[model samples]
Each structure stands twice: as C-alpha cells, then as structure tokens.
Target: MSFQLFGLPVARGVAIGRALLVSSSRVDVAHYYIEPAQIEAEIQRLRMARDAVVEELETLQRELPGDAPAELSALLDVHVMLLQDELLGAATKQWIAERHYNAEWALSAQLEVLARQFDEMEDEYLRERKADLEQVVERLLLVLSEGGGGRGRAGGLPQLSAATGDNPLILVANDISPADMLGFRRSVFTGFVTDVGGPTSHTAIVARSLNIPAVVGAREASRLIRQDDWIVIDGDAGLVIVDPSPIVLEEYRFRQRSGELERERLGRLRHTPAVTLDGEPVELLANIELQSDAEAAIAAGAQGVGLFRTEFLFMNRNGELPGEEEQFEAYRGAVMAMQGLPVTIRTVDVGADKPLDRLSIHELRQEQGLNPALGLRAIRWSLSEPSMFRQQLRAILRASAHGPVRLLIPMLAHESEIRLTLEMIDRAKQQLREAGLAYGEVQVGAMIEVPAAALMVEAFLDRFDFLAIGTNDLVQYTLAIDRADEAVAHLYDPWHPAVLHLLHHIIRAARKRGKSVCVCGEIAGDIDFTEVLLAMGLRSFSMHPSQIPALKQKVLRTDTRRCSVLRPARGVPD
Candidate 1:
C-alpha cells in the first residue's frame, strides 16, 4: 500500500530509493545484575566502549571533507566532549560498581536521570539539548553491544550489496546523530527522513551541505516503513512516500529530472551578473555564520558577505565565550579571505531562542515569562553588557584594518539604542587609537527586523550607513508567530499581506532616503520570490551560499520594468 508522510523541509531536492529503516528502539537495554566479582570486568568494558566511541568520533572529525559545512566539525567536537564528560565516564562506572548492574543498563539509567533533569529546564534551547544527551548515550550503548567493531551492519545501517540494483537507499530513522551521518560518508544513501530535528539542527545543516534530500521531523517515519520498501523523498515539499505506486514513482522521477535540469541551468549562470533587462545591476551577497563559509561565498560568486552572523562563535564553547583575540582572528581571517569584498559582521545577537548559558544575563531569562523573543536580545543585550560588547567591537575594529568591514547592529527598535551603539563603536575606535593600533574605515549598519524599526525607518536612515531587512524575524514578529515552533510554522508566512506591506515600506523608505538596503533572509534566497523582490525595488539580496546561483539565474532573466507593472491580482507566478 502507498502512504504519504509530511515533515519539515530542511534541504531541497528529490530522491527515489529503497527504504533503509533504522530502529529507534535499538538502545533499549535489559537490566541485569552482575556478581561483585565481575564488576571490574564490566567497568573495563564500559571504559573501552567510551574510548572506542571517542576514537571513532575523532577519526570522523579528522576525515571530514574540507568542503563540508564548518558546523559539521563543531558537531563532532560536541560529541567528543560528551564522550569525555566526567559524568558519563566516572559516574557511569560508579553506578556499575555500586549497583552491580551491566554497563549498558547503568548507562541507560544515568541517561534517563539526566534527560529528566534537562526536560525540567526552563530555557527552551537548553531543553532541546536533551536530544544531544540521548544521541551520545545511544552511541555508547551501540558500541557496548557491538563490541566496539566500529558501526557497520550491527549498528543498523544497511550494507550495500554488489549484486543489488542501482536504486538509491533512503535512510529512515527516529533521529540521526551527526556522528551517524558522518559514518555513512562511505555509503551510497541518496537521502534521509527522520522523525526528529528542526531546520536549524546540526543534522539539517550537514544535510544541506552534502546537498542531500532530507525531510526531518517526520513523526513515525521509522515505524511506518520497513527495510527494502520502495520510498520517495520530495525534500523540496517535505513529503515522504512509502511503498509508492508506479504512477507516483514515475511522477516523482519526472520531477527529479526537472529539478536536476533546473540546477544545471542555474549552474551555467555561475559567473553571470545579477542584472535586470533594464540594465539595473543588483548586488548578490551571501549570508554566512562561520568564518570558513567565506570560501563557499567566493565560490558561489557572492559580491561580498551581506550578513556574517557572529553567534556561532559563542555557541558550543562549554560556557566559555570567545575572547577578543579569538574573535579578532576569526574576523580578520574572514576579511582577509574575501580579498577586498565587504564583510558585514553583526555582533552577538543572542537571547531568547539563542541563550548564552555562561552569561549572567541569560540567568534572568527564567523570569521573562513564556515569551523570550520579545525580551532583551541582540543590541539590547549587548548594550546591557558593555564589557562583552566592547570586546566584540574592538575585535571587529582591529579586523577592519585587514579589509573592507561593516559593523551591523541587530534588533534595533529605538533611536536611543542606535545612538548608544554608535557611541560604543566610537568608544571602541578611541581605545584602538589610544593603543596606537591602526584600523580601516568601518561602515555601520542596522537590521530592519523589528516592526517598530520598519515603521520608523526615517529616523534610522540618517543614523546608519546601510540597512538590511531580515524578513525571517520581521515576519515572525509582525504575524505574532514563533517561526521555530512547528505548531505555528504554517502561520509564519513571508507572503503575508502585512509582511509584504512592511517590506515594501522599508525598501521604499531606504530608497527615498538614498541609502542602500539589502534583504538578508530566507526570502532573499527563494527563487520564486526573486522577481517580486526585484520589482519591489530590492537591488541587493543576501542569502545562503548554496542559494546564490539559482537566485542569480532569476535575476538575470527578470525584466524589472515589466515585473513592476504586474500585480498580485494579475495572477503573477509566485
């Protein structure tokens, strides 16, 4: 019987493959008591498994492709940390010795207790981290059961046979760990469907980097499909079809070919300028989170980096923030790599969704009610902590000496906030001058994400050198939707009338004031909306590196003068 399942689409593409189902309940360990005389051997067994898992993870990290997303390496680093955790190591051994329980049983018990603790946390981000704890425990349990042979058939991943047909395999799992995905590098899986993970998860990021078709958060996918069942994954539409009929399979096959052709056409435009038929040149930039992404941006032919999110430096650091030197080196490396292309670095935009656990400011978040999105974040949080803010500003200033750099302030809702941030930038420059340090001219910009800022755009035009519209957050705040919340994700529409109105107003306002504005959000990367945005007077677009080619293809083919005459009521293609 053919059946369909839907999930969050984290990566784009389509695949037809045989199902490779990995059981989620593989980690269910049996409780058994061992004699006190056998405790030493059991403890040694547990130690050896932990050591094996660590070695495997380190090896995976070492073998990761140079072109892989930087976050993939960071994910492996987190796994290595979990294996080296004292609680997972020493405490599990203590439990084994005291309770005379099997190593797997003891580890399972510890994981349950820790997971319960994490479940009770007030912060949503930290609560979501419980999955990481579970993933590591699952890996340890697998190693212990498989006798540390390094995760092959015994680990539940299918072994491709030489006699098998050429059909690709679609991996279905309750959840896939970054380590598990890394282990499959030598395999020939075409795509993956998981019952867990959001768009921003490490799994999703890695999948995108690999250009794999993936549908994540597909509840019950592992249970619904059996191994060897034919499946179709429409990653662009977030659809997973199990035991697909011949007609449906043929339909998807056509769509897959069309998608491939489209990609090939876009690939041909790699060096093409993003200009409209009327000779209006649009600047295409890339939005990157890590310093390593500079290479990708250049490869994608980005004029420069429009949005260089600096938050990744603060994350996965074991509660330790990156110091000034570390921040300086990262910024300088990115600046130098761009080779005169402007890199707009936005300072720490952490809070609410992204919390800095080590900072004292985040501790007060528990009292901020259920809505942390509206609470202190971005520029507000930076202003509250001057020392941390100054360190980042100084690093950015020092890096500016290397090449063209721009400082961007996020979540600016008030004029007072912009004034204060500018003053701080001046303060940072003064400190550099006092220290006899040389720095280049750094342009300052602000993100027009807050509805308040969008409406009061005139006040900001004179204060900031350039403006960038972050449609992702603007839509969320305007529609009162939590974009990350799957339950409310449908309501988070970029095409909402109110959202379009606000976008039009901001872009028009920036143009009227003779200030350059750019769109640096998901909408900017969406090829379907490229013409609409261009018609709406958006001349600069910034998006993910992978999306630049397709968007540029659209830009080159668009005649903005004709598009400006077309209205939504005229049945324009979306």
Candidate 2:
C-alpha cells in the first residue's frame, strides 16, 4: 500500500513520474561526537573538495548559456564562500587540535559552539543561516566517511524519480537546508514530508518557494509511506495520507486542480499595485539581510527596500568590526539594487540574539542574566561598544552618498539613548566633514520594540526622522511571553487587546507628530490584517519580498476609509 505526505504549499505543478520516499531510522547521539584529529582531517578533506567544486563551477560559468538563471551561479558562489569561512574551518580545527578527539565528536562539539554563536545573532536571516552551517558540516563529514571527493550531494533519502516523467514526492529525515531544497527539480517532484521542521524552518521556506505540498515534523511520516504507494498531498493544511481511501484521493485531485487555478489567478496580481477597494495606497517594501535579496524583491515587484538587516556582515566573523569599505559595498549594493527606492538599514542590533564573540570576549560580557532579551543587547550593546557602533554609522553615512538611506537604531527605551545616538551621529558627520568625505543627508529612526519606546512615542517622533514598529518584540514584551518558547508562542498574540492598544497608540503618536510610521514585523505581511493596519492609518509596511505582492494586492482592493471604520472592540481602544 502507498501513502502520501503533505508539505507547505509552494504552489502546484504537474507531477513528472516517480516520487522519493523517506524512511525514518535512528542513530545514537554519540555518533555525532567529534574529536581533534578527526576535525583536522575533516577540514583538510573539505578544503580539497571545495577547491574541486570551485573549479567545476568556474568552468560551468564560462560555458553556460548567458541567459541561464543567475541563481545557478549564486549557488556555486555560496559554496565557495562557505569553504572560505574561517570560523567554520578554524573553529573546528581548533577543537580538534586542542582536544585531540575523534572527528565525529569534534564536529559535534564544534556544532554546539556554532549554535551558541548563532543564538547570539540579532538578524533573523543570519540567525537562521545556522541551519545552512549545520547542513554543510553534515555533508562534509559524510564525504570524508564515504571516501568521495569534491562537494558531493547530501545523503539520506534516494532520488527515486526520473527526469523523463514526473519526479516522486520526497520525504526527509529532518529539516532540509536551503541548498538541498534549491537542488530539487520542481517539475519532477510532487510534494515532501519531514520528521523535523517548523513553519519558519528553511525547509518550509523552500517548500513555499517551490509551490509544493509539504508536511513537516511528522515524527515518522517517512516510515509510514511505502514505495510506489499512490498518494496525495495537501500543502495548504500540512496534512498527509497513508493508503488514503478512494474518496480522499478524489478529493485531493480536485483540490490540487482548484489550488492551481487559484494560484494562477493570484499570479496576475504579482505585477499589479496592492491598492485597496476604496483607493487606499499602501507602500509595500522588502525586508532583506543580503544584498542579493534585494534583487529577489525587485523581481517580486517591491516598491523599495525596508529593514535591511546589517548583522549578516558581522556573523561567523572573527573581527570586532567589519571594515568601512565592506560596509559601504554592502550598503551601496542594496541602495543601487533598489534603483532609488528608500533603503532603511537597521544598525547593528547585537544583543543576546546577536553576540559579537571577539568583542564579548574582550569586554568580558557574560550571558548570566535571567532574561537575555531584556539583557544587554541592541542599542544597549551598541552603547556599551561605542567604537563598534561608530564604525557602522560611518559606513552608513558614506553609503548614503549613493542613494536614499536611513539608519534605524533598535531597542530604544530611554530618551537619553536616542540623544546619545544622535550625538554620535553628529560626531561621525563632523569627522567625515573634516576628512573631506562626500555623504548624503541621512534620516535617523528608531525601532519601537520595547514598551518603553512605545510609551515615549511622542518623544521619539520628535527626536527621530521616522519610526518602524517591531511588533514581534512589542507583543512579546507586552504579553510577557517569549515567543521563542513554543509553550508560550500561542500566547504571544498580536490581535490581543493589549497589543492592539499599543499599536494604535504608536501609530497615533507618529501621525500626531507628523512622522512616518511603518510596520516591519511579521504582522505587516499578514493578508488578514493588512486592511486592519491600513484602517489604523498605517500606510507603510515592510515585510519579506515574497510577501510584497499579496500585501500590495490587498492594499489596492481596500479603501482606507472603509478599513478605518472598524474600530477596536471594547478591550481594544483606538
């Protein structure tokens, strides 16, 4: 009997031929342990493999069709960059040489160390890159054991489908990395299932991008499916079927077709403006970490860039500060990519989530506090490290010469912090003037993440050029719920009366002060609430590039007045 598993709805395409079935198996945790000599050997092996992959990629670049997708080239470049990452290579080697342990043990130990590093990063995208790092390490280790050389593919489930026909749906053991997900042939594959992954996991992102039905954290969905078992997948609901009854199969076929038609309908709006029914205009901007992401956003029809996370430049790095030139390049790239659209780059918001180890090591900062989010981080961390903060500000000032750019300082709680930050910006501008460097008049803004920042909105509006409400932290702090904790994630509701009350106040404050207020949190991307946000007099929102089109379409259909008519219920006040 055959079974089917569902995944995130990426969209739909015709099934080619065969599908890949994943079976679950267990191994002891000790098997992942790494030792010293093993680490050294693994590094050596990885270097050699990296070299070979680089050469092959260069060759492909030279010979490939000029019109070939740039993503192919980008994939190869990412491989080269990973191999060159000193932290991954050096850190692993250090453990091996110092501890003299086996390769598996050493790698395992190093992974924990890497995880700690990831946990300290403030940028969500960069923080998520830990998944990529973990996947890379796994692949490198497998290569060494298999006696293969030169960037071999990931090992786990077999690729069961053929190119001539549709590919089989795939199921995986754990969360799939972006690289592995990118390698899937969308036309051949139907859908996928995994034993591990969450809504925000890389696998989910990939599944969404590819428009495939995917089910994650199925425990042992792989074990339940047999080879060649005819199955159906429902991506929207994240459901799966094992030897599904005839009725269910028929239902899925109808759903699959209807889903495809609906997407086709939505596809038309990809290039259209996201105006609302009553002629309310909403600005849809993209949130990005890497410069390359800007291109993706533009392709998706974003008006401009918002929430350019600058932390990726600092991650997996050994230096206390990224060089001014490097920062300028990153900033300039983003500005130019937007083709004159406003780019708001959040200054380095290092806190418990994003920790600079070298700086922390030298500063002797300890994560001993009971609550890390409230501990020294974001603006607090910057205030602690003046030199590091200055370097970033200087870079942004220089990069501003290229295009419209704004600096958004995160986690502002007190009026003094904003005053101090502006003072530093003045000093930076003065220093640049003295040095005869050309720069632009840049806008300074603050992220309203803390309740203190929210309460002092009028003061902040008076001080800053703009305000971007970070609902994630605002909701978390207000509800006293750590959204990271799964047990309490449910409680971290944005729709809650308290959260709505806070949000309304912030918007009203911004408007009263005649300053622009935009939402850069996940809430902004929600189709369900786009109207509500606009109704609340919020005309600007920044979200992931993929979210821009839908939000835009929602905006074009919604009338500002109609949306505003709906007031907050009794518990919530507008």
Candidate 3:
C-alpha cells in the first residue's frame, strides 16, 4: 500500500530513492540483512562502533570537572566498564556473523540476550546492572548510526550506504543538527526527511543550502519509514510517498526529471547580475558556515559572503572552545577563499537552541522556567563571557588584514550592551597591537533580530556602520513565537503586517541614514519575497547559496518602477 506523509516543503525538487534511517536515540534503528560475503564487513563495523563508544566514554571521564558529583563520576566509570567488557563485543560480533544481522541489530540483539539473563539472575544488584548495560549498548548504537556507510577525511560520515546502484539513498532521521547536515554536501543521499524541524530552522536552512529535496516536521517519518524502502520525495508538495506502485513511481520519475530540467535552466543565471526589469541592481550574497562553503558561494556567483555564522565552530567539540589563533585561521580561510569579496563574520552566537555541547537542553532553560529563546543568547551570551568574546573579536580583527572582513553582532537590544560591545572591540584591538599581531580595520554591523532593536532602528543606524535584518528572529520575536518550536512554528509568520512594517521601517531608516542594509534571513532567499523586498527598497539579500539562482531569476523579472503602487508596508495585509 502506498501512503504519504506531509511536512514543510523547504527545498523545491523531486527525489526518488531508498530510505536510510538515522536515529538520535537507539529506540529505532534500521534493521536489514547482510550478505554472506559481507559478514566480515559487518563485524568490522561492530568493532569500530565499540571503539568509538569506548573513546567517547574515556574522553568524558578524563574531562569530568573536579567539582563534578562523586556519584556522577562513579556512574560514568560503570558505563565505561560495561562498554569495554570483552563479552559484549565478542557476543555482538557473533550475532552479526552467525545471523547476518546488520551492526545495530546485532548489538541490540546481544543486549536483549544479556538483559534476559540478568532478569533471571538471583542477585538483585546484578539484575539492576541490566540498566547500565542497556545504557552502554545505547551509546554504541548511536555511534554505529553516525558511522554511516564509510568514513572520510576528518572522520566525516561520507555516505549513508555502500550500495552503488541506480536508486540513491534518502536520509530519514528524528532530527539533525545543522553541523551534521553540512556533511550532506559530500554524501550520496539524494534527499532527507526529519521528524521534527520547522521551515526556518537552522537545520532546514542548511538543507536548502545543500540543494537537496527536504521535508521537515514530518511527525512520524522516522518511525514509519524502514531501511531500504523505496521512497518518493515531492519537495514542492512537501509529500513523502512510501511503497509507491509502479504507476506512481513512473509519474514521479517524470516529475523528478522536470525539476532537474528546471534546476539546470536556473544554473544558466549563475553569472548574470541580479537586476530588476527596470534596471535596478540587486546584490545577492551567501550565508556560509565553514571555510569550505566558500567554493559553493563563488560557484553560485554571489556578490560577497554575508552572515558567516561563527557559532558553528564551537559546536560538537566536547566542550573545548576554539582558541583565538584557530579562530583567526578559520576566519582568514573564509576571507581568502572569497578572493577579494567581502566576508561578514558574525560573532559567536551560542546558548539557547544552539548551546555548547557541554550544556544540555534542560540546563539551558531550567532556571526561572525560562524559554531559551528569551534567555541569554547571541550577544548576551558573548557579553556574559567577556574573555571569550574578546578572543573572538581579536581573531576577527586579525583576519581583517587578510581580506575585507565585516564584524556582525547578533541579537542586540540595549544601549548598554552596544556600548560594552564597542568598548570590547577596542580592547581586543589594543591587546592584538600589544601582542605585535597584524590587524586591520573592519566595518562593524548589528543584526536586527529582536523587535526592540527594530523599534529603535534610528539608534542602531547611528552607531553601526551597517545593519542586517534577521527576519527569522524578527518575526519570531514580533509574534511571540519560538521559531524553533514546532508547536508554534506555523505562527512564526514573516509576512505578519507588523513584521512587514518593521522591515519597512528598518530599510527606510537605513536609506535615510545613507547606511547599507541587508536581509540575511531565510526570507531573504525566498523567491516570493524578491519583488516585495525590492519594492521596500531592499537592494541586498544574503541567504543560502542554493537560493540565489531562483531569487536572481525573480529579480530579473521584477520592475521596481512599477512597485510604487505596492510601496506601503501596511498595504501587504490588505
């Protein structure tokens, strides 16, 4: 039987492939048969998974702070012992070899066997150890799932399957972090479905940048989809079709080809400048994370790099923050890669939804029953940790010498925060000079994310060299919607009359001040907003590289002269 699941259609394309499932927890894993010839390979996977878990446990133990609870340390040690026990690895390997089960299934089967034996044990303490054993197995299961098909440089999981055939793989996961989704650029996966994520999520934003078909917020996608199941992704319709009949498959294949042709057609606009039909030039920029993302930006013919999120450097590092030199090199690489194009490096925005690996989700929002969105994040987190903030600032300042670099601060709403931030930048420059380090000047800008900042746009334009409108957070804050929260994601409207009014106010304010302004949010990349924003006097857009072509196409068709009748921001709702 054929069934379909609905989600937010983020990227527009069609993908027909086999489902490859990844899980955040061990509760659901892909179970498939292994070929007789591949039994040894499966055992090797089990060994690698075990070793990875062991390494992770050892790292945790070594990094445990001296102030950590005695019981917590002891519990970690117990889990390490369970993971290192020879019997666990030996028995799990046996399951793979004898039963031809895949790595995750084999290891889980062994855990079940041990669990049953413990349930029948006479000693209560030994029986209770079953929970510890289960924890160890769960950890190993997560490693095996992330290990994917093969490993690449920097220990990246390159592909989802070793199978080299006609049908490509489609990743189905409970949820994927933005850092993990960056790996998709090199992976063989044709498309992906996440059980939880809103349309404007950072992960979804990264998915769009990857230029792959994606369906997010599919409530039961991970639970319902099984390994190696034939799947059809109608990204335009936000539909995931499973077990499609031959007739339906044929129809989808045709649609897939049509989408491909359309993409190919858009590729022709890569080198063309974005100009309205009336000859108003529009600048399109790219929002990149890693240094390697520069190639995609240049290939996409972006005028420059805007909104270089520096926070991604601090994620998934096991609590170890990148030092000033490391940060400088990373920043420099991006500037150099742009080859004279300007790169705007936003200061690290960690906390809230993008907490450091050391801080759990609960820890981020436990105090005052506070919502992370409203908690200390972005500039607040940076301001709270002045030393770290200075380190990042010094690095960005040094990178300025290599190429044109712009400093962007996120989520600022107070005069005191702005004053402190400016003083810190001066202090960082002084420290770098005292250290005899080469540095250069950079234009400092502020991200207008909060409604408070947008309301006081004149104050921001007065102090800042430029302004970048982060429409994602602007709408969320304006509507009191947590953009990342799926429960109210639909309420997070970028087209709210108030949101449009704010955008109009900010853009109008910037123009009046003769200061440059750019929209570096998800809505900036949306082709639907190209003409509307152009009418609002927005001449610059920063977004995922994949979004540029279609937007440029829209820009080429828009007539700014004719938009005078549609100029009023309040006229949007009417």
Give a tens-digit lDDT track for model 1, residues 26-114. 56454345667878988898888888888988999999989999988988898888788887788888767875657876786577556
On TM-score, the leading prediction is 3
Sort the predicted structures by lDDT, highest score first: 3, 1, 2
Q: For residue 121, what is the lDDT in candidate 1?
A: 100
TM-score of 2: 0.65
**Cα-lDDT of candidate 1:** 0.80
Give me the runs in candidate 2 sitting further than 4 Å from their true place: 1-148, 152-235, 238-264, 318-321, 351-370
Q: What is the lDDT of residue 163 in candidate 1?
A: 32
Q: What CA RMSD would you report for each candidate?
A: 13.5, 15.3, 7.8
Comparing 1 with 3 on lDDT, the higher-scoring candidate is: 3
TM per candidate comes to 0.70, 0.65, 0.81
lDDT of each: 0.80, 0.67, 0.83
Q: For candidate 2, lDDT tens digit of each residue in 310-349?
A: 8757754545468887998999998998898889999886
Off by over 4 Å in 3: 24-41, 44-167, 361-369, 568-574
